[model samples]
Target: MRKKTPLNKQIYLSDHYTGNIAKTFQREKDINILQWDFSVEASLVVKLQIESLLNYIVKNVKSKDERRCKYLLPLQYLFRYVKKNNITDILKMEIRQEKEYELFVPKEVKKNSGSLRKFIEFCRRILFISNKEIDWSANVWYVEGLHINPKRVSQGTPILSFSFLDITNSDNRKALQEYVNYLICVTSMKMNTIRIRQTYARDFFRYLEQCNLCIFDVDYQITVKYMKKLGTQNLKSQSYNIKLNAILEVIQYLQTRNYIARFEIPVLYHKEKEIHTVNDIYNIDEKLDILQKYLYLFPETLRIMCLVLINTGVEKGKMFLFRDTDFYWEEGTSWLRIPGENRSIPIPSILYWIIIQYMKRNKLTFDAQLFHNERGKKYSTASFADAVSKQCSKLGILDGEYIFKGSMYQRELCRVLYRSGTSLQAIREYMGYSTEEVVKDIVGWKDEKVAIKTQEFFEDEKHNLGGKLLMAKHDKMKEINQLESLHKVDFALQEIKNYKDSGRIISVTELSRKTGLSKGFFYKNDRVREALDEVKNEQKEEQLGIIRKEIIDYSLEKQLEVYKRELEKTKQENQLLKRENEKLKKALDKQTLQYLKLLAET
Candidate 1:
């Protein structure tokens, strides 16, 4: 069933898509032609995807019994819908897009949406292998599909979708896929995490497209705008943080590859995560007391296991796998060797005696299962915890809810030990953890209120250096040096002012001669140097001002002479106008007299 082929052979020819898709895969004997319902109206790219997908399934599906149409139907339903809706880019299709065709397809294929997701995951991987960037450049990828580890993901493998609200650019769509590739291959992000990341990434891509921006155009300001956009959506603080982290990861990747410049994003949107305060840890003691009150209700083995869990707070997995050699005596003190820890933590004396008694009564050897079911098989962590929760429910704790989950007791114990004055290093070893971070969170190591108080204390004293000096135990030698320097600076400044007032040239040499201070004092002392420079600058400014005033006065005198000549010209023009008016009046009077004489003659 397994056939090894060259990586090049696995790559389908892009030219093969031009011809009939059926004829291209007719020679692929493993493919069942009847199962494929290729409509005549299907476009070229859709036809190519359908053909490539069949070939991929044939190569990957190993057992003959598993090669059924049901396994292929989910993607087929998706492709048919894609073709019907005239979608050209399969890479832009989302996992939940199949729901659009739900009314058109049978309910069985709807149930197979999970399988469709797995197929999409396969597509993403193969796309990465083909282009090394998940660009989806080719119609098909040249790579083998491997099974995902079931233990890595819970609730089946999580799937990602690329269809965003406004992702119109083809390259940006491919870039989103490339980000998915980075998450999968490079970061090994869990599918559940990818799903969450994909949500924010989709929002980001849609945002970029809506703003008519590409990845290269993203900057701190652009991210600020994006944050404002998220803010407008009225997202929760935690949800907003997820959005920030998702976009930050994308921005960092683009910057690393030189697609965008690196810039710091303001963490204004950041809100502190809710943590278990010391009071919360104290409150958990009430539940512990309840469990202790109902301790005897369980069978002896379960009761002892419950007691050990509550007292030791070891990880459930390691506790379930505990053996006879794990418990020992060190210098008359009882110690329990946690698996994976270099040193052992001391156990309660009474609990230690009970464990020793249980081991002896069971006749357990050094590698034998100390705690087991009736069949003597090792008990699972899940089953052991379930038993504890069931017994607690019968005793009426937290309304029948299983509150004692993974590492709850361990976290509680870490906080308790830390508050009880145990060092972080001791707590880390006690909890079988490799670092203090685990216990750090449980103990609320970074106190925001304390940090704020410290900051305020520093800020208050920041400008109060006088008070600091006054309160300090003074050294006579330091004070004398300071006084001498201050005296020299004062004397040099006064001499510079005297030189300016008396109209004398001022220089470092003149200052030194007047004040009997070293010439270096005027140059070396900051205050003296500044005062000297200021006086010299003022003198130069005064001389420049005088010269500027003389220049302005000369220009004003020239302008006054021009105004006098223009006034004389205006007077001559007015006199000419008066003479012309007199001549016209005389002519009118002579014409009137001539008309009067003519009238008398008639």
Candidate 2:
């Protein structure tokens, strides 16, 4: 009789000597956590094929969890189907999306909505090809996958996706489509930036639709309308400026393309309501004491989530998209390597240890996600942010005026960097700010590093013109002309803003009369016009709210009556709950006697 092969060894190292995940890796990753027992009976040749496939998958795949999750179950199903059918060759087993979709996406499964679609994407990523090399994408994915587009899965407040189809004008629709496809997708802009642009672009387009105007003929009037709408919003001044600037960039892009008439707009005209001080950092000793232990003792998902945010200044949305593979370790250093970013963020040594410990506790192989729930799916950014916020609130470290939902990490990290005397460029790089000024502003760094040293230093034309022999004189002229034009416009805009900041009313009549400027000039100058209109509209809304106060009072009276009724109903329900609790307590005592009697009899 032929000697029987060991079943467990047969599963991984049959005739397929491609390699094991541990031995195959040249760089010694601490992957002992990935080893698992395996035992399956199969034909020698079939086992060989299985081993070969597994090696190929394990070698190329980033996460052990993903490799096993996507392949192992399917492979088992294939083995069962083949053995039951008594097929000579196991290669003929093929998965059809239709039946698989039915099995995976059915409501009978535990709340796994659209998981079949996710599976389809997972399949696409791995490329479901047979050993014979079948081109399945041509038949399966391209045909069925055309309709498998993901819904706008917003991770957090900032990553908003807009449906451009909402725009009614054909020209506007075409332009916006091109903007999304060509400008956003094809260009080198970051994903967060792209999303921000999409949000405000949609807002601008929707505003245009409401006014029954076309973007191709976008003029100064509708921009004023847009500014006026923005002015009445409940956004904080910084957030207000961020949104306004994002929208303004797109408007500038449109004007640059000559699709719309050019206009200048300032980010914000609002004065600083409160001065920022070092006191904003708040109770450093208490926060560190809480977080140091909390970071180690908390659940793997929460600890690693907080650890990453604190160490690396990645946005929360990017954290949601993290796979365990993204946590790349080399030698002793660990890096959070997100796609599309040029730099690999080095994790702090202490946090790296914590991260590894957390991963090991959770039994995370290279296949599992870094920040997923027990179900192996990520929570939304908002959900994660709420968790962070709640924890911070309990610690009394939560900022009263948070700029972003999940800003605790960024704020703390910036504090550490600023205190460490890290350079503005380095801070900008870490925080992913494009400009030095932005980095300074966000971190509240009170330094003139990004500011112009002296305006008079480059007063001479020759000194201003660098030794770039290729730069034509006319180019310099163009630059100077643009600056002069922008300066003139900015001065007027700032004047309007200053007037408003001083609590001076700036209506068309008031502004024109005060400055002795013509109404036509005030209305014609786009920057002056928009700022003036925003101030007027805000004042008008204030007056309107005052005039409408009686209606508000009547509504409040009705609300008060409703509140009283609700309070009475809630009190009655609580009383009913008390009686029900007493009944339940008596029943529990009766059940205890019955259990005691039964146990005594036994």
lDDT to native, each model: 0.63, 0.57
TM-scores, all models, native as reference = 0.40, 0.38
Model 1: CA > 4 A from native: 1-69, 72-169, 177-200, 206-222, 229-249, 255-279, 292-312, 315-395, 399-402, 405-408, 411-427, 435-602
Which residues of candidate 2, in runs, are more than 4 Å off?
1-162, 185-187, 234-281, 293-297, 307-361, 391-602
Top TM-score prediction, candidate number: 1
- Tell me, what's the RMSD of every candidate? 37.2, 27.3
Tens-place lDDT digits, model 1, residues 1-602: 22322342332323434234334445445443234545346676666665566566556665543444444555556666777788776654543453465565667555644455555656545443543344434322222321345333432122423333245576676676677667756776666686678667877888788888887788888888777777777766666676777788888887787777989775654443634343243356456656676778877888888788888887666677676667665564557887654667898655666776676677665446688866676677567667767777777775654545655776767766765458888988777776888777777787745888776675454544556563343345557889988887777777788898898767664566567886556655778777877887787576646544443443355456568878989999989998998999999999999999999999
Q: Per-residue lDDT for 364 in model 2?
A: 66
Candidate 2 global Cα RMSD: 27.3
- Candidate 1 weakest lDDT stretch, 10 residues: 138-147
